[model samples]
Target: MDKSYLDNLKFPASFFEDEVREGFLVTSMMKRYWASQLKVLSFVVQICDKYNLKWYAEYGTLLGTVRHGGYIPWDDDFDICMMRDDWNRFFEVAKKELPESFQVLTLSNNEEYEELIGRVVNCNVIDFGPEHMEKYYGCPYTVGIDLFPLDGIYPDEDKEKDRVARTRKVLKALTLAELADVNNHELYLLLKEIEKENKVVLPLNDKLKNKLRLLAERLYSECDVTECGNVALMPFYIPNNDHIFPRKLYEDIVELPFENVYLNVNARYDELLDLEYGDFLRVNKSGGVHEYPVYSGQESILAEHIGRNPYRYTLDANELLRSVQRYIMRMTRTVDKDTLPNAESMAGGSCADSGAVIKKKAVFLPCKAKWWKTMEPLWKKYMDDPGYEVHVLSIFYYDSDYNGNIGERHDERALFPEYVQVEDCEKFDFETIHPEVIVTQVPYDGFSTFMTVHEFFYSGNLQHFTDELIYIPYFEADAPIEKGDKAWTALSVMVEQEAVVNADKVIVSSDAMRSFYVDKMIELCGDETRMYWEQKVESFEKSAETEDDSGRINNEDDKSDMNAWNQFLGKYAGRKTIIYYITIAFLLRDTGKSIGKIRRALDTFSDSGDKVCAIIVPQEQILNDLANIDEALWKQFTDLVEKIKTTDNCIYDEKGFSLGYMDKWSGYYGDASPLVRKCVQAGIPVMIENIDI
Candidate 1:
């Protein structure tokens, strides 16, 4: 083996240099993810056909089918919605009727199979047949899937659709909130205790809790004022008394052909589908991993490459070997030895040149070179005489012309037989391409990321791909990007903030980002962390930090915590709160309203015996206005306040009638109003000082 090729090899930036390209790859991977999704959708069609069940591609999945003709390529999974009755019926059958390789997984079933919940439920779950079963073989975890149930709603010509839409949104929010809850166990316990103490009982128990949750969640999700009013005061609990889909929306169901399978689709699909996605019926042009490299500025090739690629490469192979062998020769080349560099030395040198040696010894794959060459010929001869298979992986991508100007090159290079396509690498059944050996063109640091897949390719069901496995990282693991450190830092911050208390404690601004965060958290916390409703608030509360729970003037210890906490709550008054606005208003309204109303609205906060309740009035005008209240009405209110008394609590804002100017701000109804701003500034929390009635 010679050192020329090893010396010549230099890291290439063409494959991994641009953030845009890398982002495109991420998007492309989603497309690949959907291929698996569509397969599941096709199966759903089969299930509906065989068992006579009715289903609709509801919500995003429905939007995808109607608009794009299949699963949304950008989407990582698929969903099907059924009426509540149909959902129950399907679950009954799916439990006993689904193929052994696949089954209906639900949030309710999280306890039985720990892996089926959290990010696992959020990941792609459609099996690509029995051959792909090994993907989950010994996984000890379940991946994500899609199935939504459409609950009953009261019939209304104008409001039903809006109600349905709102319900779906709420359901989604509940799902996200519950799944993100870190302290689910604690929350569940809290709810259990709360329920046990009261007979007036809000639904927060086990069997009935989920049902109650579905009901509350449904109401919260409702968008139509009419439908909400209809159900707002219904006597006793009603569980989806109305049909999941109104008769007008779904008059009849029809079957459609998809990938050789028949699927039941909503009858009015074309109009709705066309409206959302005009190209809703085309299959993908290609089926594999798409390479989208970032464009590197020539000045910072290494840094840009690191930024673009998930893995790193080893270019200085000769220098690497020399560094390792230098010590060897220095230590072994003694006076007693012939100094001839014996067969042992040659064997070691030959090992350096051979692919197997490189695969076993090299930390990362060597990059392709132009000028310099390695001792490949010598290594080839050494292996040929001794009987060893040699295969090397290389990446080919567009490069500049000789003039150094940016231009595309079209050189067709023979990739190593071991260089498996990324798509082929996805599934576990890798037996088709048999060889004595295999090599990867991946960088070193990225090795850990793909280690599981590679391990399966060699020792497990994929043994047919290679008789013997040779593992080399695509690039060196010690890339400059420091992703591992970033991850560690994130985890550290999470611990410090107690973000793990519930999933939502780690607030993400978008659903996509939320999904990513949830996946990472689940990966960190494993299956013991399931989703629950009670934990949702706790998690959200931590992230929001809008209230100072420690500010209660109860215990002496809490006093020290009160100053900063009160200031923090005051700060929250000026900022936008994404938390439930209506709930906040309803709770605060109790301060100026009847004692019974306050007690009913915020049972937990109302009973907290040692908390100061303040009604802030920033205007002298409002206070003067309050002084003009009817004496009899004021007396009645005073009596009510006395009955609703709690120690360590008060109704005065020491800041008094001093007011600050409020700039124009947005309101919950998506309107900008200076009057609303004035109300917020002068009469927020409550205008108790000015409430004459």
Candidate 2:
């Protein structure tokens, strides 16, 4: 590379004097440091590009671009700022994309490094610190660039000041807490003094950093950025000035050349520069008054000279590099031949050597084991046809007990054939596996990976991911709601409304469901978008032939092969069976009354002894909520069921034996349930409790 870029830059006389005193080459050191910074910036830019996150140059980096067309002669650090949302998104993507050479340091990740702003540090080289700064001295320190998050500020001046003041105090306390761990008594004492001076008590503890982080988040997110007049870098801790700038100045980005690479900067760079540094174009005399830390090319040499490396506690570079490489390869690698169409054709221009049209890629994300029944038919339809390639990513282990500690659900896995490929949520990579169409049953925030999809087909709730959105409304029973169930009901209604409003095409099982969702959309969004919602929603009746046996049959010959449901059914031979279903809502409301009614009804039927059996099935939610029920009510309900089970013709199957075993029953009697709709469609009579048959 040419060294000509550094030739024309003027250096202060003190710069050379300091280099002689510190025993390092001033010009060569700055050049090396600048190169290292550019490397980190390049890696950051690469990550942003891969993940579609936006970032811009800020502070010293921006100042250097306009005033010097590169690094300021005296400045050694690089700075970048992103809107709060982009900043968070970058961190999420960086978790997988950042190379080993770099480490993103924040208060949460490295408390000892204790700065509100995040830093992307180069791990390859160490910076030798000044002797007086005992904390950083003898530490292996890397040259790093600051990444400040610009958060929305309150529109009112007084509110903005109050927010800044509160955030600053928390930042001070957090810094002190970190210092306390390092045995920096003076700084800790200073924090106590500040607290005493302000007539408040702030504890120096481990939670200080998290408390500060939460406060900062609230300051940024409490107000809407677009509506607010100004945005500020809340954690910068600048005195007198709040560091707030006009929102317009930072909203749009423009490209500017820094060193050999072009980087994004605020569109109104002139105003931003002037606000931060008055007369920014003028070079400061007296060496700019900023401390310049000595840099070393070799880690061991710096370590030996300083007695220890300060950054040893930071992230491991080699491990991070390997992880980054794996992530990149996984993202760019060709899709497996079994799961996709021609790999070469998908990568290159055409679909096949025959010059046929390319097959589109579609992915299905089922949130639970039960959802597979709804999505599998569509998956098979596409899998059999050559016009499309299909893949399944399921959150099968979402049952509360299995969450966070996921184990193989062998039963759920058996639902798919060996030829079909299914990936669990934890292992699925959204960036690497690009799908043209995405079908999802649940729109919970847990499946954030689906946000990257181009064409989204939501079977239930709505998500704000794509314009090419398709909504498929599923059947959900409207059970009687108690006072505590109102929030759950409201959220369910909101999710459905959002799905209808954003849907480009809405598919429902019946005209009644279509009309119901349409009215909901109009209620939530008003009549202005009613025509659009009405035109998009259409009913698609489920095919009669598509219904499969509700329960998985085990015919392995061994006595142990029989499931509990089959074992329970085996007890009754040549008897007419009626299956009854119940939900958590039914149990939680009028607990004593509902149980009493059930007991009386079962006892009345048992007296006849007409060679009939009644099987009860409770949903999983009801079983799980058993622990939360009032102790008195739970005991009464359990005792009632026990008493009812004594009846010769009644069998209380509390383990939900009859849920998917409707095929084994002669008739159905239950509160309105999703299964009721299916049974009614299959020409089976359903006697709903509290409603006319």
Which candidate number would show the highest TM-score if scored against the true structure?
Answer: 2
Q: Report lDDT per candidate.
A: 0.33, 0.54
TM-score of 1: 0.30
- The CA lDDT at 682 in model 2 is 56
Question: Cα RMSD (Å) between model 1 and the true structure?
Answer: 25.9
Model 2 gets an lDDT of 0.54
What's the lDDT for residue 160 in model 1? Answer: 58
Residue-wise C-alpha lDDT for candidate 1, range 50-142, written one tens digit per residue: 777676655445654333333433333445655545555666666455446565565454433322111113123333233563232211122
Candidate 1 ranges with C-alpha deviation above 4 Å: 1-23, 26-43, 63-71, 100-141, 151-153, 156-211, 217-267, 270-693
Question: What is the Cα-based lDDT of residue 550 in candidate 2?
Answer: 26
Task: Estimate, for each residue in 422-529, the C-alpha lDDT of model 2 and write its tens digit.
Answer: 775556554465555566654322222112121223322222332233444322322212321322222233233333443446565557556655665555456775
> So what's the TM-score on candidate 2?
0.35
Alpha-carbon TM-score of each model against the true structure: 0.30, 0.35
